[model samples]
Target: MASDAVTIQVPGPHGDRDIRVSSPSRVLWPEQGITKLQLAEYMIAVGDAFVLANGHRPVSLQRFSADIDGEAFFSKNPPKGAPDFIRSVPVVYPSGRSHAQLVIDEPAAAVWAVQMNTITFHPWASRAEDTDNPDQFRIDLDPQPETDFRDAVRIAVELRAVMAEAGLTAFIKTSGGRGVHVFAPIEPVHEFLEVRHAVIAAARELERRMPTEVTTSWWKEERGAKVFVDYNQANRDRTMAGAYSARPLALAPVSTPLEWSELSDADPRDFTVLTVPGRLQSVGDPWEHFADDPGDLSTLLQWWERDLGNGLGELPFPPDFPKMPGEPPRVQPSRAKKP
Candidate 1:
C-alpha cells in the first residue's frame, strides 16, 4: 500500500509502515518520526551547507536506518540513545563538517546520508596551511555495473592491509553495489589535491603486489580479470555518492550496511531492505572499532615511495582517449566488442 502518495504497510524498518520512501515525492521514517515530505524538506536545507560547500549532491532519505555492521563499531557504552536504530534518529550531510555529535532530537542527517552515497574520507593527509575538511576526496566506482562480490571484498581487505602497513587506519564499507569502498580517516588540514595523491600512491602499490587480483586502470576494458583499483577516483575533481543509505542505484535499491569481519567472509546476497535488522541485532555490529585511525599521510607516503615501482612494469591503461608517450593503447573496446 505504498506509492508516490503517502501510504502504509509496504514493509520497512520496525514494521511495514515503519520505513518507506515515495517515488515522485515522499519519505516516511516511522522509526525516527520523520515523514516523507519533511525529510524531503531537509534534503533541500542541507543542500546549502553540504552540497555547495563540497560540490556534492544530496541523496534522498528512506523510512529505514541503514543496516550497518555495528557489532564491531559502536561501543555499548555509548549514551542511552547512542543509535538503537528504533530509538535513535537519522542525519543527513550533503557536504560540510558536522559537529559529528549525534543528538537524539536532531541527529546528524549528513552521516545518515552516507548509506545513500559512496563517500570517501581522506582523514589525515593535511598540509599545515589548509583549514577545510582534510578528509576531502570523491568516490567513483561503477555505481551500477555487473561485478564479482568476492573481488569487491578482496579490494577492501587489500586496501586495509595496505593502509595498515602504511601506518594509517582505513575503514571499509559495502558500496551497496557490486563493490566495496575503503575510507581513510584524515584530519582536516590538507586540501583535496594532496590527499588525492596519497590515495593514488596507496592504490598503485596494491596493484603491484596483487597483480592478478587487482587492476589500477582508469579504463574498464583494461581491467579484464582483476578488481580495478581506480586511482583516478581519488581525484579532487571527482566525488562518490555516499554509500549505505539510498542512491539512484540505476533503479531503486538502497546501499545496505555490513560488519567489519564480514569482509573476510560475507556475500552480497546476505543483505536487502527488509531482512537486515534482525541480522544486525543477532550479530550486533561487526566493525565496532574497525581500525585505530592515527591520521598520518606522511607515513603512508613513505610506504608508497618505497613500494611503488616494485610491482609490474606499469598497470594497464585505457584506450586512445589520450596516448601517453611510451605506453601502448592498453584497452581495445573495438577488439573486445568483436565476436
Candidate 2:
C-alpha cells in the first residue's frame, strides 16, 4: 500500500525544493522495514547538520540495488543524468587519476541521492576548492575482534587529551559500528601527506600512552585485541561516513555526532534512522560549532619531525598507492622473506 513515487519538499539556504523518490516503499533496511521514502525523509530531517559536516566536499555515494544486504557499489564520479543542482568537483585519486566527484550542497541534493539508491555518504577530509590540502584531521578508532565500543570510547578520550596537548580540539562520533571516529578541524595549509604524518604522530603518542589498549599497526594480524588508531584515514582520497549519514547496516544506524561530556553514555544502536531525528530535536546538533575555530597542524608536525629524528620513519602506505618515498614494505610482516 505504498505510492510508486513521492515528492519531498526540502528547505535549504536557497529555498525549498521538491525531490522525487522512486519506489518510495522499497525497503532499504529490511530489519526496520525502512522504506526509500523514509530514508529521504531522514535526510531532510538532518539536512542542516548533514550539509555542515559533509557539504562542499568530494563525496562518494554507496548505492544499493535492493536491501542493505543486497548488491552494492560506490559511485565516486557524478553518475550520468544527475540533476542540475547536484554538482561535482575534480579530485585526484590515489591511483593518480583525476576525475570529477559529486558534491551535495543542500538537503534536496541528499534526498535526490536517496532516490538514486544511495544508502551511505563518504565525504573526503578536504574541501572541494582545495582538494590537495585537508581541512579536517580524522582518526578512525577501529576495534579488532574481542574488543568493542567501550574499548574505543576509552581510547577516544585519551586521544582527545593527546590532541589537546598538540593544541587541537577533538570531536567524537559513532562510526555506525563497533568503532568510533575522532575528528579535529584544521587549517587547509598542508597537503594530505603532511596531514597524514601529523595523524601518525598523534597516533604514535596515543599508542605510547596506552601501550596495551591501543595500536597503530597497519596489518590486521599485528593489531590483536587493541583499538587501532587508523592514521591512513587522513590520506588523500580517503574518507569515512560523514556525520548524520545513515549506514547500510541491518539496524539502519547512523554515524551520529556527540558531545564530549555525553560520549560515555552514548549507545550506537540507539542512534538509528528511526531515533536520531527525535534525539536531534531534544539535544540539538553536537557539532554545530565544529568549524568555528580551525587549528593548525604545526605542533603535530613538529612531533612528526621529532619522531623521525628518533628513527621512527615512515610507515607503510596503502597497497594501491604508488610506493611512497620512505614507506616500509607493503608486505605483511609474517609473509616477508628472511634476511
Predicted candidate 2 versus true structure: per-residue lDDT over 3-85, tens digit per residue: 58877899999999988888899988988999998999999999999999999999999999888999999998877888888
lDDT tens per residue, model 1, 69-187: 11112211113422344222122122332322222111133333222221221112122134233453322233224457676776666677777776666665565567776766566
lDDT accuracy of residue 276 in candidate 1: 43
* Full-model lDDT for every candidate: 0.43, 0.93
TM-score of 1: 0.53
Runs off by more than 4 Å, candidate 1: 1-132, 136-147, 247-253, 279-294, 303-339
| Prediction-by-prediction clash tally | 47, 0
Residue 83 of model 1 has an lDDT of: 35
Model 2 steric clash pairs: none
Instruction: Show where candidate 2 strays beyond 4 Å.
Output: 1-3
